[model samples]
Target: MYDEILLPVAPVGEANDAITHAVGLAERYDATVHVVSAADTAVDTLAGPRTGAFSERLVDAAEERVEAVTDELEAAGVETVGSVARGDPLEVIENAIEDGADIVVMPSHTRRGIRRLLLGSVTEKVIRVASVPVVTVPMAESEAEGERSDAAVDDVGGASGSR
Candidate 1:
């Protein structure tokens, strides 16, 4: 029941899962995938003139991210389009929805406790704001477990046991 699938890609590896999920949905519904990346360019005023250069770089990087994801999805036989926008991430994604996104399929990165509290989450914000359905594929269980295991090991104050 989806006509347009909006896949908001992160600039990091977390996007792979989201891409896989969105591509699968797109294949099933024969829908077009609109892959978008946000260039977070909101910086302090003291940064000044450097902000222009920084924004340009971020936009360029975002474009590359979208292009790469679009190419991969298209190669898999899905119709895909890409766009890069600069501003508050939530607003940029909301604008994509306004542009005609019937649904949004995005990955929810694992941010825990204080970190989650302080940084909030893009997926959460989008879900709260977007009018359309938002399908959030959280970090794969295995991946999340692995990350927790690694963190647990690191948290050990002093591991006297020899490997």
Candidate 2:
């Protein structure tokens, strides 16, 4: 029943689950998948002219992310379009929705309790505000474990348990 499927990804490379899910849904519905990545450029004025350079990097990373996902979708035989936008992620996603997305498919990170509270959640916010259906693919267990391990290492000043 979907004519256009929207997939919003971060610049990270951990969205395979969401991509797979979107591919299946798009194939089933014969819908075009529109992949979008948001470059979060919200910065304080104290950053000054450096903000332009930093924003460019973010936008470039976001463009790469969109291209990667679009390639994956097209390789899977799904028609796809992609773009990178600069702004708050939620706002970017909402604008995509308004642009003609029938539904949204995205990955939800595995963060809990204090971490979840502190880091906040774009997926949660999207679910709350989206006018169309939002399908969330839970992050793979291995990915979640990797994130936890990375966090632990960072917490200990990059010292690993093995060393």
Candidate 3:
């Protein structure tokens, strides 16, 4: 019944499962996957010029994330459209849904306790507010750990491998 499947991805590598799940569902329904990445510019905007630079970087990263995800989906022979929107993550997603998404498929982090509180769960928020069906793909613990390790290596001047 799905015609457009919305898949929101963060700049993190934890979205592999969600991407794969979306591909499968999109293939089954012959739906076009609209991949979106949010460049969160809502925080620390009082720095003026520096804030503008930072927001630009965020948008660039979000664009790269969308491109990578769309490339993967297209490689799998699934129809895809992608965009990088600058806004709150939830707002970007909500706007995509309003643009005519039939369903949403997204990654759910396993953050708990204080961590979850400090970094609010967008997936949980989407589930609560989205009018369309929300499908959450949980990231495996090992996969999450691997992503963290890769980030650490990248921070130390190591190159990250492709997905």
lDDT of 1 at 116: 63
Q: What ranking emerges by TM-score with the best candidate at the front? A: 2, 3, 1
True lDDT of residue 73, candidate 3? 94
Q: Please write out the lDDT profile of model 2 over residues 90-163, one tens digit for every residue.
A: 87889999999999998776777877776567788889999999998887988656545543111101111210
Report lDDT (CA) for all predictions: 0.70, 0.74, 0.74
Give the Cα-based TM-score of candidate 2 against the true structure: 0.85
Point out the worst 10-residue segment of candidate 2 by lDDT: 154-163
Q: 1 or 3, which is superior by TM-score?
A: 3
lDDT of 1 by residue, 1-163 (tens): 8989999874333235778988899999999999987766664244577867756665776777788899999998999998877666777789999999999998775767875676456778788988999998777776545534432111101011110
TM for every model, in the order presented, reads 0.81, 0.85, 0.84
lDDT of 3 by residue, 1-163 (tens): 9999999887545446888999999989999999987766664456566867766666776677788989999999999999877666777889999999999998776767865675456778888999999998877887756655543112101112211
For TM-score, candidate 2 versus 3, the one ahead is 2
Q: What is the lDDT of residue 74 in candidate 1?
A: 93
| lDDT score for residue 13 of model 3 | 53
Two-way lDDT contest, 1 vs 2, winner: 2
